[model samples]
Target: MQLNVERGAPATGKTIRLIQTARASGQDEHQIITGNAYKPADLELLVRHRISRGAKVICIDECSEQHIECLQRLGGRLPDELTIHAVVSY
Candidate 1:
């Protein structure tokens, strides 16, 4: 499962929600790794790692259409082994 949040959006509760849900489900300390990237390579490792660990990948702070487009494109090409959730804020 992957989560992607758009820029300028309030993500105040997203991480908490995931943590709570994961804990309630009896999952171990859900490895929550949050980060940002202006380049594809910068996010590659983290994205792949999360996917490999069966963890959701989230993208936060996407403010521009170009950013959204890049994220969408990347999502489309990501390995089928992973699921992504994206929250875009206009």
Candidate 2:
């Protein structure tokens, strides 16, 4: 599992690069999510569900501090086999 946290300014093509990288990695299952689409708790639940469904990679675009905090809360709960990519823009 590889967790890639790409943090930088907006309009930097972070999301684009993330998707390209995930596709190039040949992962069978990858999901892309927008930060504002869900609250912290909801995001955690969604991630857990995806993990249970054998998702290999999960990408979060425009990721916020709340998103990071939520994932941090999951800590030991997150699957070791799943990779998370968070593209956060300031």
Candidate 3:
């Protein structure tokens, strides 16, 4: 899987723009999941579900270190075909 991390200060509209672009491109909103530093397990579950639903890319807004940890834990567990984009807000 390919992981792209976009980091910036909070309320910078990065997440919003990502959502808008995804929607404009006909991607399902469900494929984009909002996350935080505290919800690693939840994020993992959501990613798994999205992949099962045939989503090629999964977007996570407000990502954090915990989210990275979750991804690390899920390393090699998720399909290699998936692409993950994480928008991290400080």
Global lDDT for candidate 3? 0.78
Clashing pairs in 3: none
lDDT of 2 by residue, 41-87 (tens): 88888888878887777877777888887787676766677778888
**Cα lDDT tens digits for candidate 1, 1-90:** 343453334665554555555555444443433333345455555666666676543433322455445656676666655544433343
TM-score head-to-head 1 vs 3, winner: 3
Every model's TM-score? 0.45, 0.83, 0.79
Q: Which sections of candidate 1 miss by over 4 Å?
A: 1-12, 24-30, 37-40, 52-70, 85-90
Comparing 2 with 3 on lDDT, the higher-scoring candidate is: 3
Q: Return the top candidate by lDDT.
A: 3
Off by over 4 Å in 2: 25-30
Best candidate per TM-score, number? 2
* TM-score (C-alpha) between model 1 and the true structure: 0.45
How many clashes show up per model? 12, 0, 0
Better of 1 and 2 by TM-score: 2
Instruction: Provide the lDDT at 37 for model 3.
Output: 36
Q: List the residue pairs that clash in candidate 2.
A: none
| C-alpha lDDT of residue 33 in model 3 | 74
Which segments of candidate 3 are over 4 A away from where they belong? 28-31
